[model samples]
Target: MELFFKYLQYEKRFSPHTITSYQTDLCQFQEYLKEVYDLEDISQADHAIIRSWVVTLVQKDLDSRTIHRKIASLRSFFRFLVQQGKLERNPTLRIKAPKLAKKLPAFIEEDAFTQLLDQSEFSADYKGFRERLILELLYGTGMRLAELTNLKLADIHLASSTLKVLGKGNKERILPLNTSLATSLSQYLVKRQEAFPNNNSPFLFVTDKEAPLYPKYVYRVVKKYMSSVSTAVKNSPHVLRHSFATHLLNRGADLGAIKDLLGHASLAATQVYTHNSIEKLKAVFEKAHPKA
Candidate 1:
């Protein structure tokens, strides 16, 4: 397990959070095997044993998505074992997880976001400027939370109206910003400079003390403002990302363009947003097609 985590950290370049999740999933499975089947060695576990674990997980009331991820962690670990000659065949090779119902991603209406920005009262201080810019960057660029979090001072090119983003797996992409977003960011930079003249933090978004923003800080900031404009079931940075993609698609942006803007490697990931578009189309057809 230690060696696998080392490989994930050094070779796979996976984030500490992702590595920790894989560790947690593996440990839970190991404990289940020990308690239920008295199986100490994971290598000795067979397909039937794995299926029984799946049944137990289902009985424990875990959602299908989570159970699928746990199984995926197991599959990857067993594949590693097979490569290392510890196991002759992967026990999870034929094991299948339950199918999950597709759920469309939720996004705040563009008008709501505009109202939140234009009419809402935010402190006229550097801190408020910084917080507002965070929302604009995520919604305007369609970049992931991690990409926005790791944004470097040099990555923003105001003159070009573009932002260079380092996405999943260290892949970098340049996102062209709208005029409003560019202007907002430019103004925020001036406020930040005046407030923290001696700031040395390389991150784009920082706390009031000029410290780099942490994940929870980002989440809380997003949730507080988003909750005011939207009663969304889930309010986080990703909701802004979904708003970016969904709004673009609704306005007739090409699917491929949205995919590139979101920095998604495969079209499959980007197609999830299309489901939102399809629902709108269905509504229009139902209301206007006269077939109803």
Candidate 2:
């Protein structure tokens, strides 16, 4: 376990959240091994035993994505063990991850998004302004919830209309802001200073008590406002992110640029939005075709 964690920290350069996920997956696998085979060391595990574990996971009715993640974790762990000379060969080499259908992400329409923003509950009060800013920034920048929550005051450059965000794997990227978003952010900064006064919290968004906003607070705020806006789609920050990307794609934005703006590690990850755009085009064609 220590070796795996050290490998994650050094070789893979995974972030704390990703490292934590790997640790959790390994811990769960270890617990399963203990209960079923009374095995403590992964190196002692064999191919048949690993196959049986996969069967058990299937029998337990875990989702395809969850099963895939477990397989990934096991593969990484055993490959590391083999590299360290603890194992003769990797047994998980033949284990196949469950096939999963690609489900297109749900996104809010442009009109619905505009309506939500127009009707959002905003006030001159510090918390109100802070929440409003959070909403604006999420939609405007398409930043991940964790990225937004971890934002530091120094990361924002109002003069340049750009924000430096530290994304997954500790990779940093510069995300640009629009005029409206920059204005909203500036106003919020002024309100934040007045509300917090002498307090020195470096985070961009904070609570009423002047502490940094937690993930749950952000989720609740999104859920509360999104519930009023639309029941057609699930209410989450990620949905807003999807809306942001989809809207950009529908408007003919370049795929490469969108990938960079969203801080995706690869173009393949960003290409999923193209599926949503195609579906929209198909709908329009079906409605407008004279032959139909």
lDDT of each: 0.88, 0.87
Candidate 1 per-residue lDDT, tens place, 121-190, comes to: 7788998898888888888888888888899989999999998998776779999989999999899889
Model 2 residue-pair collision total: 0
Window of ten residues with lowest summed lDDT in model 2: 225-234
TM-score of each candidate?
A: 0.93, 0.95
lDDT of 1: 0.88
Show where candidate 2 strays beyond 4 Å.
Answer: none
lDDT of 2 by residue, 59-111 (tens): 99998888888888889999998888888789999998788968898788788
Question: Candidate 1: which stretches are off by over 4 Å?
Answer: 38-40, 289-291
RMSD of each: 1.7, 1.6
Worst 10 residues of 1 by lDDT: 115-124
Local lDDT at 53 for model 1? 92
